[model samples]
Target: MALNGCSIWGCAKALQPATSTLSLNSKHDLGKCGKWRRCCSSVVNGVESSFQYADRVQVQITELDDGFHKDLNMLPKPLTANKFSSSRDGTKLCVAYKGLAGAYTEEAALKAYPKCETVPCDDFETSLQAVESGLVDKAVLPIESSEGGSIHHNYDLLLDHKLHIVGEVQLLINHCLLGLTGATKENLKFVLSHPQALVQCEMMLTDLAVTNIGVDDTAAAAKAVSLDGRRNIGAIASSRAAKLYGLHILAEGIQDDDNITRCLILARDPILPETNGSYKTSIVFSLQEGPGVLMKALEVFGLRNINLSKIESRPVKRYPVRLRDDSKYESIKYFDNLFYIDFEASMTNPNAQHALESLQEYTTFIRVLGCYPVDKTDISC
Candidate 1:
C-alpha cells in the first residue's frame, strides 16, 4: 500500500456515454485508476495512455488488490456528426447557439466550425439542452467576459448538465449601435440590448443622451425595431445583426473596451487532443474541513510541476453553512465550498496522472470536467 516511490495504474477503459460515474476503490494507490478515458484512450497496466474525452466525473470503493481492474465506469463518449439531421447531401454539419442568426454566439459557432450550419435557440439553457439531447452536434455558450467578468450562471449550468467541454471559442466583441435607415444618433430616443450589452456600452449610451433599455437579446432588439418600423429606438447589437435586420450601423465597436467573451463548445462526447500540445484539464473537488487540507491538495500539482490556469471556489448551496460549537455548543458557523480548478497538463502524462492520484487521497470528492486544447487566441485586438 506504500506510494513512496511506486505508482499504480488502475486503468478504466473508455466508456460509452451512458455511465459517467467513476469508481476508484480506496485500497488502490493514486496511479491505479484515476477515472474515465475517451474513445481512443485508456490506462493499460502501469502505462499512461493518451485519451480523447468529452470531459465531465463520481463514487466509492472496496478494498486492496495489486493489479485491481474493477470497472470505474467513467462514463464518456465522443461527439459524432451523426447526431445532426442528415441533409439530402448529408455533408454539412450543424451546431447550436442561443439567439438570432446574427448574434455573437452564432458567430462564435460559425467561426469555430466554419461551413457548418448554425441553429439558434431562444435562450442559453436551450442550447445546452439541445447538445445534451443530441438535437445538434454541438452547442456554444459564453462562460466569461473580459470587461464584465465571469457569467456565473453558465458556471452553475455546467454542473446541472452532462455535456463535455470539447472546445473553446474566444470572440472579440465589437458592439454596434443599429437603427432604422433614416434614424441617426441625434434622433434616437431609446436604446435596447441585452442587459450585459447595455452595461458594456453604458458610457456610449449616456454620451448619445439616449435612454437605455435592457431586453432579451441584442438581435431581438434589432428585430423589434425592424418589425415596429420605429425610427427612434436603436439597438446595441452587432454589425451583422444590423445587416440581417435591415438596420443601419449608427455606431460600431461601442463596448467599454475590446471585450472578449470565452465561449465553451459542448458535445455529447469529448475530443482527444494531441499528447504533446498545450492542454487544460478542468475539475471540481470538495475537501475535508481542516487547516492546510486545501494546501496539501494543491501541493500535488505543484509537486508534479503541473501549472494551474484557473481556480474557482463556489459555495456548496445544499450545505451552505456548517454549524460548529465552541465546545460549549455556542453558535459558530463555517462555509461549505467546492473548488473548480483548471490546470495545464495532458492527462496522458505520468506526472499529471500522479498528481490526480495524490489529489484523490486528499480530497473528499473530485470530478474531471474535461481535458481540452488551450484557447491561445491572440489578444492583440
Candidate 2:
C-alpha cells in the first residue's frame, strides 16, 4: 500500500486464472437440477488455450464434493488500484462543458494546457462525476458568469463531492447571433439558445418580434438552427461555434451587457497557487444550534480582519430531525446546515488558520474548498 504510482495490470494479473475461467460442468448433473455445465470451444491462440486449462482445473474442484450436503467457501476478493491515481500522469483530462467542442470552457482548458485532450460532457454535474470516478484527471467547471451571475449548481457540487478545486480560469464570454446562409434579422421569427444566453441578450432581442426558445446549450442551439436549414431561425452562441457549424453571423456582441465573462474552476486535488498575491480561500462549515451560533461564527473572521468575499447558507440534509414548536406544523425536521464562506486571505496566511481554529469549537463539519489566485482583471472600461 505504498503511495507509488498505480500499476495498470496489477489487479488483472493477481486474480487466479482458474477463478476467472470457471464454467458449468454437465457431466455431474443431478438429474437436470445440477448448476454446473461444460463449455466446449476451440482456442484461437495459446493464451486462450491456457485459459481453458485454467477452466478445467476449476471444474475438477467442483467434482470432488462427495456428500449431498457440502459446505462451500468463497475465495478472497481481488485488490484494485488506488482510486486517486488512475487518471493521473499522462492520462487525458476529461472535461465536460455546456457548449460545443470549440466553446469557451474548452478554449480555457486548451489555454491552460495546450496539449491536453478534452472530453465534452452535456452538463456541469456530469463533468464532476467524471473527475470523482477517476475517469478524468480534472474538471473545469464554470462557477460564475460576470454578466449573468453565479452558476449555483457548481457551488453546490463542490460541497457534495470530495474533489478539490486546484485552479481557476477567467474567460471573456463573447456572444454572437448566428443563422443559416441568406438568413436575416428581418426574416427571422424565432431565436434559440440556453437560458443564460437568452437572459444576456434579453434587451437585444426585445427590438425584434422573434420567439425565444431555451435549449440545453448555446452550441447545440446553433447546430440545430444550422441543421434545420431554416431561414427564419437564428441562434445565440459563440463566434467560434458559428464558424464551426458553418452558420452566418447576423450580429456580434448580442449580450445586453458587454462585460460578460465566466469564472471556471479547475478541480481534482485542491492546492494553493504557487505565486504570491492577494488570495481568496473558500470554506464550508456547519454550526451547532445555539442563540448566537451564526453571530459567533462571523465574529471569528471579523476578529482576525479577514474580509469575507461571499457567504451563503444551505440546509444540511444528513442531520437528525426533531419536532417543531410552531402551531402551523405538527411534523419536525432536522436543523443541520452548511455555510459556504469565501474570505480574502489564503490558507497559507496565519489569520486564516487562526480564524478556522477559533470557529472549530462550534463547527460540526468543516472543509476548505480551495485557495486560488484572485481574478483581478477588470472587465469595465
Candidate 3:
C-alpha cells in the first residue's frame, strides 16, 4: 500500500525525556480494528520497562490493509540510557561511528566512552540513522577539523535529523601513508585519501609527485589499497587502519600540520548536565532581511554577557531566492540564509533563556539543537 504522507503512530513522535533519564509512556493504536497492538516502553535508570525497541523490526503483513498498521514498524525508536553506560559503570554501551572499524571516528568514541561497543557505518548519515532507529545508543561523527575547517555536510545533517547532541570529543589526528608490505614510497605513483585528508597533506603529496585520488573516507581508502595489492598505490589513513587492514605504514604523520578533528556524540535524548559544569548550546535561526537586522539579533547575546563560540550561515534550501522591495528602489532578489550558532551556556541558565526569548522577537524561525556538556580532556596522540 502507498503510505506516502501518512501520519502513522501519532506522527512518529520523537521520544520526550521527562527527567534526568527518559521515562516515556506513549501509546498509539494500530490498524482499523486496533487488534494488533504493541506496548510502548519507558526507560528508568537505563532499564526498559516494557517492549524492547531494538529487536522488534518484524511485523505481520496481513495488518497492512489498515494502512497505519503496516507502516508502524518504520517509525524511529529511542535508545535506553543503559546502552549508553560506560564499561566502568558496569553497563555495555553500543556506539556507532562512520567509516571502517579502524577509522579515527572510532578512536574518538572509545576515548569518550571506554570499552563501549563500536559499530562501523559507511557514512555520516548511516551513523545518525542507526542511533535514531535504535540500532545503537549513540553516534560519534566528525563535525570539524582544526586544519581542514568545518565539516559542512554534518552541519546540514544536524539540521535535518531529530537526534540530540549529548557530548563531543576532539581527537588529535595522526595521518599515516599505507601501502603493500613490499611497496616503498619512492615507487608509489599514486595516493588515495578523503578530499580533506588530501588537502591537508598537499605539500607532502606534491613532494612525492604522485597523483592523489579522493575517496569516500580515509579508512576505506586504506582497505582498498590492502585488498587491491597494487605496489605503486598508497593510501593516507590513520595508523589504526594500517593495523586493521594488514597494510604497511610507509610514512607516519604524513599530514603537513598537526590536525585535530572535533566529533559530536548524538543520541535520541539529551543529557541532564550538572549546573556547576561547563556546557555549550547549539542553535539555528533565521531573520528577515533589512538594515541592522542581523546586528539587532546578535545584540541579544552581547547584552546578556553570553559568549558565542561559533556562527555560520547556510542558504535556505527550500526558499533560496526571494524578492525584496524597498520604498526608495525597485524589487531586488537575494538568497535567504539560515544562521547556526554555538554558545557557552546551558538552557537551564536564566541568562540563556532570556537571550533566546529576546532573540525570538526579531527572528522568523529559531530552534535549540542541543545543550551538551563541553569536552575538556587534554588530548594527545
Candidate 4:
C-alpha cells in the first residue's frame, strides 16, 4: 500500500468459480449449464497465447503521493541521462511545466505548490509524460483562457492520457510586448508568440502594424527574439520572460483583454477526496444516438440539485459524423460529440454520486476526470 516511489498496480485475487445450473421449468434449463469459460492472453515476442487464469477478482482504491519516481519505463519517451531532481535536496516535490522559468505555466505550478521544485519541458506533452513516467510528482497544464475559452487541445490530451487531475490553479494573464535592447514598438515589424497569445493580443499587434508569428511557447518566443537580436521582432509574452531573456518591455498588458488561464494539476494517481471543502467534479461522457438522451443525462444533475459550472462538447475521435433525418428524402450530418461537464460538488457527495449513477444510465461511456477542491485564489491582475 506504500505509494512512496512506487506504482499502484491492481490488487486482485482469483477465486475458483462454481459451475452454473439452470431449470427449464418455464424460466430456465434444469442442471444443464456447465463451468463458465475464461481465458487470459499474453504476447511472447510476437506470438500470442491464452491461458485460463482467474474467474473472480477484487480491486482496491489507491491515492497519489510525491514518491513516484520509480517507474521510468512508463515515460512516453525513453529514459534519458538527465533525471528530474529536486531543487533542494531530495525532499521537495519535483513539478513539471511546459515552458522555462518565466512561462505562466511555471507560475501556476508554483502557485499550487509554492515550495515544490519546478522542471521545464519543451512542450505540454513532455510535461504530461514527465508526470506519467514519474519524472515529476505533478504537472501544470493550462486548460482554458478567459478570452479564448477552453484550450481544446488540452481537453483532448486529458482523454488521451490516463493521468488524473488532482488540483487546479487560475493564473491571471497580463501579457507584455518584449523586444531586444534599443528596439522600440514603432520599429517592430513582427510579433511572435504562441498562437493563443497572438490571438489574445490581436488588436494590439494590428495597431502596431506588426505581423504576428505563431511559435511553440511565449517564453521560447521571447528567447528567440532575444537571440535573433532583431529590432523588427517583438514577442508577446510575460513580464518575467522579458526579464529572464534580458529583453526590453515595449508595452505592458498588450493582450486584448485581462485574461485568466485555468490550469489542471495532473498526476499518476487521484488525490484523496475531502468531504467538507468546496469542490468540483469533472466528467466526460458519450451517449448513443437518440432524442433527449443528452437532456436525460443533464437532468440527473438538475434533479440532484447539483449545479454545473461548465458544459462543453467535442466530436468523438473515431466516429466524428452522425446522421440525422431532416426529412424523408433529406438528411443532416452532425459531429458525434463527447460531453465534458463540471459540476459544483465533490465525488464524496452522495448527491453527486447519485447524479453520476443516474447519468451513466443514459450514457454509453462515462469517466470522472477528477473531483478536486475549487481554487478560490484572488487571481486578479
Tell me, by TM-score, which candidate is best: 1
Error of 2 at 111 (Å): 4.8
Off by over 4 Å in 3: 1-91, 323-333
Candidate 2's residue-wise lDDT over 44-104, tens digit each? 1221122123112321122222231111112111112232234346555555444455566
Q: Sort by lDDT, best first.
A: 3, 4, 1, 2
Q: Is candidate 1 or candidate 3 better by lDDT?
A: 3
TM-score, predicted candidate 2 vs. hidden true structure: 0.69
Local distance difference test, each candidate: 0.66, 0.60, 0.68, 0.67
In candidate 4, what are the lDDT values of residues 145-185, reduced to their tens digit? 77879888888777666677788998998899998777899
Summarize candidate 1's per-residue lDDT along 139-178 as a digit string, tens digits: 8979887887777778766655666777788899989998
Q: Estimate TM-scores for all models.
A: 0.74, 0.69, 0.73, 0.72
The residue-level lDDT of candidate 1 at 33 comes to 33
RMSD to native, candidate 1 = 17.2
**lDDT, candidate 3, at 339:** 84
Q: Judge candidate 2 at residue 170 and give its lDDT.
A: 68
Q: Which candidate wins on lDDT? A: 3
Error of 4 at 104 (Å): 2.0
lDDT of 1: 0.66
Model 2, which residues run further than 4 Å from truth?
Answer: 1-94, 111-115, 146-148, 258-262, 272-275, 318-335, 378-381
- Residue-pair clashes, model 1: 12
- The Cα RMSD in angstroms, rounded to one decimal, for candidate 4 relative to the true structure is 15.9
Model 3 lDDT per residue over 81-135, tens place: 3343222332668888877666788889999999898877756887777777777
